[model samples]
Target: MRYSKFLLPTSKEAPSDADSTSMKYMYRAGMIRKVSAGLFYYLPYFNMILRKVNFRIRRGMEKLNSNEMKFPILVSQEILESSNRWNAFNKEMFKLKDRNDNGYAISPTNEEYATLVSNLFVKSYNDLPFSIYQIQQKHRDEIRPRNGVVRAREFTMKDAYSFHADEKDLHDYYKLMGEEYTKIFADLGIKTFPVLADSGAMGGNMCHEYMAISPEGEAEIGFCDACGYAANLEKVECKDIYSIDGTYKNKYDKIETPDAKTIAELMNMLQMEAKQFVKSMVYNADGNLVMVLVRGDRNVNEVKLANFLKATNLELATEKEIKSIGSVMGFVGPIGDLQNVRIIGDFEIKGMKNFVVGANEKNMHLRDVDACDIKCEWADMRFADENDVCPKCGAPLHVSQGNELGHIFALGKRYTEVMDSVFVGNDGKNHVPFMGCYGIGLERTVASIIDQHHDEKGLVLPMSVAPFKVDIIIVDTKKENQVKTAEELYNALEDAGVPVLLDDRSERAGVKFNDFELIGVPIRVTCGRSIENGKLEIVRRDNGETVEVEIANAKDFIINMIKNY
Candidate 1:
């Protein structure tokens, strides 16, 4: 394809609205254009790259015996209601009304649709362990869509669902899917770590997320370099706690700490480390008043708290609710006038012999209150930090940010049982099928690839997903010899089964070079004065390496270099 014939409108400056490096470069390289806050239009160049990547993913799926299928982008509300996702999804789901006034939703995921299809088609045990996949558009009403395509409201995704008979079959397919994910990421030339993740709202016991490390990522992962233990912070466990000496001479005393509410203010007045103080918060879990206690320095992991209480509904209690419970806003404690609120404390706080706590009255705080003096159920209810010890191993944890590209989950019988999707087992009994879901955010993968593979100039596309494998540039387009040589090389590369782009416009050498660099063609061949010498200059985008080869050997050299690179 000639550069002029294609919509390769390379720009030198990034759009003002582009927030991330990937978004900026994609806009500048003419890959995509923003239509709204979280919506974007994939231009021709972006579409071409997407097609190539999709083809590669499809090829990998075929090797795993996964059949490809297409499902509707919009699903009826009845389907989601039957699956119990209507209430489970809450506000994150985009719901609309059809012409007939029936409710419909843009699917955020396809687990329900896939399970419905399986129930209608698969009747016997012979169709038990089949996997189906599709690359289609998905929509979610994200609370805050930032970091370019990494957190978008509408994006393309490749979702695969596998149905199985038992735990053994599900585990086997899960392992196979993991291997396929490793291969796919390797083929895309990106380094990713498969880390354990919490199955949020998916109603599963086990899940894994493929995270690509980046400084701008939003998800926090706890990794232990020594023990090789990695997990998402939501599910990471810590076992270390601050030890309190029994011989310490600090005595329990009530002091006036008027209007000093937050931990920082209390710490300043007392001139002590945050570990020396205790923090308490109030929450409403399933319409029941609950109090949570933790160390002042630690943050509460709400997800873990919700799971601990086994409550589907939980939210931070409002100030008005706290006041109505006969407790001051800043002064709350476990020991007070008897109330019907449940008190849950962190295990670290319980282990402390003498800890500081609120006095439950205005202008007063209780210091050196021991855990044995208070009554509450305690557990590891706080967020894991760098100072915490790994639950699996004794090594210290390290925190890093990452963007989640793919997630594999063992859904167990959550959706199947709710939707009444059953299959006949070998015993001739009808049982709910164990389900697993695997998902890849196609646009986010593209964005992550750009995030991991770019420099100050622009995108450094991988050869497998580059819009064109080779870009043939006539450095002096007006020169007859250069033009003829460039055209001949372009045709030769195309005839040799290479995707080639010919830059045949009458542009300056610097402009052409910058355009080629911005567009990120993996390889470039320049025909200039070297044409008269029967030599061509080949430039590699990954590393600024250039080599001179004879015109007769340029095609083979370029092909071999691309394959090796």
Candidate 2:
């Protein structure tokens, strides 16, 4: 492509609204433009890169015998309601109505339709293992989408679903897809690690998210260095490392706390460490009020709590609910005259003796409270932190931020059973087929590449996904020798099937060079005064290594270098 004819707009300054590095560089490089919050106009350059990512993902799916297909972007409300997901995704789904007043939603995913397809085609155990996939746009109404395309409302995703006859087949296929995902991300030039994830709203017992470690990521990961145990913060286990001391140090008595409503204020008044206090948190789990107890220094892992109670909706109890329970907000306790509510305590509380707790009355606290005084069931309900040891190996944990690029789930008949997608087994009995889901975000993958592989200069894009492999610059468009050499080289490279960009515009050399770097082509060939010497200046964008090659050997040399990628 000739620079003068192409709509390649390059800028030196990042947009003011750009928050993340990928957003900044992508905007400045003219690859994308913001249309609104969480929405963007993916320019031609961005589309090219997305297509390359799709190519890699398709190749990987093809290896697994997963046929590529397309599904309707708009799914009917009846189909979603059949799977009991219409209400689960009401907040995030974009709902609309047709002329007849029937409701439809832009699909956030296609599991319902994929399973329907399976039911239509697969009838017996002979067709037990079936897989299909699609590359299409998925929509979600994100409340606060940030990080550019990394968290956009509308983005391209490669989602695949596989149906099998039994649990064993589903398990085997799930493992294969996980392995294939590793290869796919590796081919895209992004390093990712799989972590145990909570299958929220997907209705699955087993799932894993492929996370790319980045500071700008929204997901938090807790991992162990000793035994290679890793999981998402919501799913990581916090082992019960405490044991009963069997010593009561102080007498249990009530004290006038006098308006100390918070842990910090109580600590300041009582002059006690955070670990010596028991925090009582009230939550309404699926409309049933419950009290949870954890140490003051810890936080409740609501995901874990919800999984334990098997509740669909869990949130902090409202002030009215707390008042109805006869407990003041921030002063609720498990030991008080609580009625008709389940009390659950963290496992660590069993070993804590003479700890402090609220009196269930305003401006009052119970001092020297022991485990024997509290009535509750013990469970692991605290979030894992650096201070917590890995449940697999007793080693200190490390927590870091990560972005989810892909996820694979062993759905285990979650949709097939509900949708009545059944197949006749060899025993002549109808059975629900076990299902598996795998997905990768195309735009998010590109954003992660930019986040992981960029420098102060501009993007340091990987050769496999770069839109153009070589950028040919005409330092002086007026110079006959320079323009002639640049055009010849550009044609030669293009004829050789190498994507090349020729900067033949009437612009300064520095401006052309800067734009070339910003676009992040792997190789740059400059046709300047050096052409008079029967040579051209070649620069490698990755390392800034410059070499002069004879005009006769330049095309072959550039093609050979790209082959090494």
Q: Candidate 2 — what's its lDDT?
A: 0.90
**Candidate 1's residue-wise lDDT over 1-565, tens digit each?**
9987888778888778788888888889998877888888889998887787788789878887888999999989899888877767768889999999999998889888999888888787888887899999888899988777778898888999989999889999998998889789878877889999988778888999999898877889999988888899988975636543454344578888978898888889888788888888889998888889998888888888888888767888887777766677787777666376888888888567556788778877888788766678877788888877777878888889998999999988888888888888899999888899999888878888888888787878998888788989888777999988888888888999998999988888888889888888889898889878899999999998999999999888988997898
**Shift of residue 518 alpha carbon in model 1, Å:** 2.4
**Once superposed on the true structure, which residue ranges of model 1 sit more than 4 Å away at CA?**
240-251
Alpha-carbon lDDT, every model: 0.84, 0.90
RMSD of each: 2.5, 1.9
Q: Supply every candidate's count of residue pairs whose N, Cα or C atoms clash at under 3 angstroms.
A: 0, 0
What does candidate 2's lDDT look like per residue over 1-565, in tens digits?
8889887777999888898888999998889999999999998889999999999999999999998999999999999999988878738899999999999999999999999999999999999799999999999999898999999999999999999999999999999999989888888789999999999888887999999999989999999889988899989887776765555444688889988988999999999999999999999998899999999999898888999999878879999898888888878887778776899999889888888898889888898898767768889998888777887888899999999999999999899999999899999998899999999999989988898888888888899899899999999888998988888989988998999988888999999999888888899999888888999999999999999999999999899989985
Query: Candidate 2: minimum summed lDDT over ten consecutive residues — where?
Result: 242-251
